[model samples]
Target: MTVEYAPGRLADLYGEPSRPTVLLWHGTQTDSRAAVRVLAESIAELGVGVIAADWDSHAADHGRADLLASVRFAQRTTAGAELVLVGWSLGGVTAAGLTLHAHAFGVTIAHTVCLGGAFMAEDPITGGPVLADIPASAFRAPFTLLVGTADDVIPVGAAEDFAAGLRRHDWPVEIVEVVADHGSIAGARYDAATDRYEPDDSAGTAVTARAVATHIVAVARHA
Candidate 1:
């Protein structure tokens, strides 16, 4: 169920906090945690703790504090269980920034996962756009990026471009091309009326979410 991780900052907690817990960060949509719920629950069902955080992407500081607050909550929940950071949409870029700058954040990420990431934007954590030539020296941990071939909102090549940049820097990274669209990868579909990604029960969506969850669990197990 969802709870307030900090004052006015909401989060959805899944399963019991354990070693190698996942911190699922959502996209820039105001729906926040809702955007990642379906996939988060799928991971939780496989016995991993997942915390899906809700933050204001339009906040004065772009909800950096809100994101960090949820991170702290995950830390407390895990009690040193180690963290696996996962990001969707713009959250992927921010998480990528945080992963590269992990030392500054004072967090050790076991593994990082990006889902249909939009990389051409400012990373709230680093306050800079994700450029192509970030030196390999800045690499802090391995990254697994999931790209959607059918994604309409963000082109697949965008993520491929970022993956190429990571490879150019010799950063440890893996890219998985999923045969799903933007929201279906997260077990959601955009609702024009609500302007949010609501839960989608289509058989195809379930398949996509399950595949993504399986990949996530594998990453966590090897972390």
Candidate 2:
């Protein structure tokens, strides 16, 4: 079921509260909880709690305030639990920013996963450099990047560059290439009639979800 952890911050929660929690963030121009609900459910099925929040990345504050609020909410609701941050598309960049600056917020992030993330360009909302320029010393946890081989939205080169940057600083990082696109990797499809998201049921979509869930569980084990 879904719960509101803060005003304007909602999460589609799955699994027991005691399980390790993944705070999932959505891409640009989408509601976080609804956009990634299916993928979150898939991860939750692996015996972890998935909490996807809603934030407007284009808001005046560049979604930073809301995203931080979501993190704080996750910390409060899932105290004593391992916390992993998962972000898709632009949200992935936001997650990276949060991880680099987590010390400022006094939060501990066990791990991070970015699916089809775009981290090379300047954040139009925040008007700052992206994750590619973050120093390795800034990261407080291990990170995984899930790139879609068929994704045309964000070039694979960007992912490679970000991974290289992290490796240069001797950070623990992994980049997994999946046979899916930007949307299918996260099991998202827009429904015109309902104006909401619908799940993608293709074989490729299943493979992508399973691969991502496996990585999340694996990372949590070592976190």
Candidate 3:
């Protein structure tokens, strides 16, 4: 469903709010709803609610303002609910940031999941580095990193490095590898016409989706 808690900003929410809520954030240059629709639905089927928020990271404010607004909306709407934050690629970076500073938003995140996340990178909004060796004490929840072994966009080593950094800080982290690429993890392909992603239904896509979904469910169960 479409959520318009803030004017002009839309978020797609899947599953019922009574279940565990997962706020999903998409990568840069992609719509959250379209990019994460398949995965969100898959997670919802497992009895978990997912919210995919649409925010343009390339916007004038670097999408940070919009992301914070979305976070507030999620917290307000899902009050007293167990909230898990999930993000893909750039969105993953943002999710990690939010989890580290969740106290500022007056929210407590149960856990965090990052898919093909780019961590310890420079922040476009602040013109400085982001997630560069964050202290473990800053994080109150565990983190799970899922990346494709064949991912070309963000190499598997990036996830390993991030995990190592977290481990050094004595943070709980788990890394899962899937047999697919970046786009295939979500069963999506670029649609040139509309500059968005379209779902793929090949046999291989189905298998990969199932594997990823299973791993996600396991993570959620443990969280």
Candidate whose TM-score is highest: 1
Model 2, 66-184: lDDT tens per residue?
Answer: 78787878888887566788888888877777676666567788888988888875553345866544544564588899998888789998888988877777777789888878887
Q: Estimate each model's TM-score.
A: 0.93, 0.88, 0.88
Q: lDDT per model, in order?
A: 0.84, 0.76, 0.75
Q: Report the C-alpha lDDT of model 3 over 55-114, residue by residue, as the tens digit.
A: 888787778877888778887777756578888788877877777666656667788888
After superposing candidate 3, which stretches have Cα over 4 Å from the reference? Answer: 123-127, 133-136, 191-196
Q: TM-score of the candidate numbered 2? A: 0.88
| Model 1 per-residue lDDT at 85 | 92
What's the lDDT for candidate 3? 0.75
The parts of candidate 2 lying over 4 Å away from their true place are 123-127, 132-139, 190-198, 202-204
Counting only residues 3 or more apart in sequence or on different chains, how many pairs clash (N, Cα, C under 3 Å) in candidate 3?
0
How much is 73 displaced in model 2, in angstroms?
A: 0.8
Candidate 1 has which clashing residue pairs, if any?
none
Off by over 4 Å in 1: 132-139
Candidate 2: global Cα-lDDT? Answer: 0.76
